[model samples]
Target: MPLILFNKPFQVLCQFSPQEGRQSLADYLSIPGIYPAGRLDADSEGLMLLTDDGALQHKIAHPDHKEAKTYLVQVDGIPDAASLARLQAPIDLGDFVTKPCRAVRIAEPEWLWPRNPPIRTRADKPTGWIAITLEEGKNRQVRRMTAAVGLPTLRLVRSSIGPFSLATHPLMPGEFVEIPVAALKSKR
Candidate 1:
């Protein structure tokens, strides 16, 4: 089984599926027989995994497997501890309550890369960053979580998943690398 680490960029779809007027993984990844282990929304950017092994894919994608996925989020407002506490606690999204999540304010990284279509900035508004890690994957969870806490997410990026990291891989938008079966197996 082969597993690859990818640094998915903003507005890049995670899957190879075709969209009417949107970009997808097909535009970037050309490795035959490879598929994303999980998905990141086109509006979100960060670490994405691709693999040829069904079991390994399932392990990484299934919420029950509880593989931690960490994200660096720039939000519309400064998040106070009380607000962050609300995030760490479970959130009821009507359909279901989200699993416990970890969130904390973080200083802006000096090395953070700029987005191609940069996040909107307002002259009269101030914003901050938060680092959140969750075991369960959900639709726009971080964005939704922040919104629920009164701080809407302006930009979202996945920095790491399990032991794989975007910092080490350092792929620009529309780039990918294939990890050999031996390395994938050795990771365990």
Candidate 2:
């Protein structure tokens, strides 16, 4: 079994588990034997990894592996350099200090599609985007980190994991593509 890289669209659940009238991996992925290596919450969207190799799945999803995951986050407030630096710097998240990461302000991305159940818009407020990369993925880590810095996330998208990039292998909502196992293990 190889890997299937997916650009999971918004409002899509990351598992095969059925919910009452809810979308799940079963709806998008028809490839048998493959399962999501990790998960993207229904409200969040972006790169999702699917594979049948249990060892490879563990390598990608294990927090201890420190595999870098990158996200493009739209936040309710514009962040200044100091705030961006704070995100790049480590902060004690109570349980642990996050591994040092990279956070930079970026222009609104043009490559994104309109999200289903779009993020709420405030008539009087503005939003901005930031690119953040983390080696450690905790539960809703990016969302929590942005909130911790006073800039709550309005939308979050995981753009890449290690060498896999969603931009290269685009997935319309409810579609999938497959990659051979050896190909997934190759250097980009």
Candidate 3:
């Protein structure tokens, strides 16, 4: 069994299968039977783990497992303390209420690469960064949560899932490194 760590670039789909003309993992990864353990939105970027083992994949991606999935989010406005509090609170999203998540203001990551098409800059409206960690992988949850708190996310990048990290693994966009499946299974 093989476990692979990939630095998924922005605009890439999480699946290996092709989706029309949009970029997919197949554009970067060629190995067979190594499906993504979890999903990252097409507009988002960062660490995405792939594995051949079903059990290991479930452990990392399952919502009930409550694995900490951390995102480095760039938002439009600097959220005040009250807005930050609202983010940590379990706000209702009409259909479902989000689980209480940890959201803390963080400096823009110095290690981050500029997006291919840079985020729109507004000299008048300042932007800031926040680290938001969630246990559930709901569709567009991070972006919705920030928006609910009046901080619209301009760019989002998932930095880690559980103990695995893009920094520790060290792969650039479109690059990946293989790890032993047994090693990944032992990690959590």
Candidate 4:
């Protein structure tokens, strides 16, 4: 089975279907039968894995597997130690409480490409980057968690999933690489 690692671009939909104006995986990938393992919102940009193997897809996407998904987030405020700790602590988002995860401040990744429509920043207020790795992905979990911790997210990017990293692959937005299913599962 073919396992594809794609660097999804900003404003691109995670699905393969065509929409009236939104761009989808079909625009970057034409290889039939491969489906996205999980979702990254259209506003978010970075690594996304696609595969034809159903079991592998389930392992990668399902929260039950507890496969870590790492993100590079730009938040509205300069997150302090207290705020960063709050990110790693269990927090409520009304519908559900988030699982404990890694959250740390990081220098802006120099290798990261610029988004098409750049993130808005305030002249008076400062913005900073934080790397957050979560095993469970709720609907807009990163955004919600950051906001709850008093650090509103401005831009969010999934830089890695399990053993697959956008850094190691180094694919530009819309670029992809094919890999063996065994290679990925073995990394687990």
Using lDDT as the measure, the top candidate is: 4
| Candidate 3 lDDT by residue in tens digits, 63-153 | 9898999999999999788988998989898889998889999999988888888999989999999999988879999999999989999
Per-residue C-alpha lDDT of model 4 across residues 44-92, encoded as one tens digit per residue: 9999999998998998999999889999999998988999999999998
Candidate 1 local lDDT, residue 39: 91
For candidate 2, what is the TM-score?
0.93
Question: Candidate 2 residues 1-188, lDDT tens each?
Answer: 76888878787788888888887888777778988888887888889888898988999899888778999999999999998999999977777788799999999888887787788998898899999999888888888899999999999999889887777777665556777767765743
- TM-score list, all predictions: 0.94, 0.93, 0.96, 0.97
The positional error of residue 184 in candidate 2, measured at the CA in angstroms, is 1.9
Tens digit of per-residue lDDT, candidate 1, span 1-188: 66778777788777788987887888877878878888999899878999877888899999988889999999998989899999999999777799888999998766578998988889888999999999998888888899988999998889888877777777776667777777766776
- Alpha-carbon deviation at 83 in model 1, angstroms: 0.9
> lDDT, candidate 3, residue 22?
96
Which runs of model 3 end up more than 4 angstroms from their true locations?
A: none
Cα lDDT for residue 88, candidate 4: 98
Candidate 4's TM-score: 0.97
Q: Which stretches of candidate 2 lie over 4 Å from their true place?
A: none
lDDT of each: 0.85, 0.85, 0.89, 0.93
If the candidates were sorted by their TM-score against the true structure, best first, what order would they fall in?
4, 3, 1, 2
When summed lDDT is taken over every stretch of 10 residues in candidate 4, the lowest stretch is 179-188
Which structure is stronger by lDDT: 2 or 3? 3
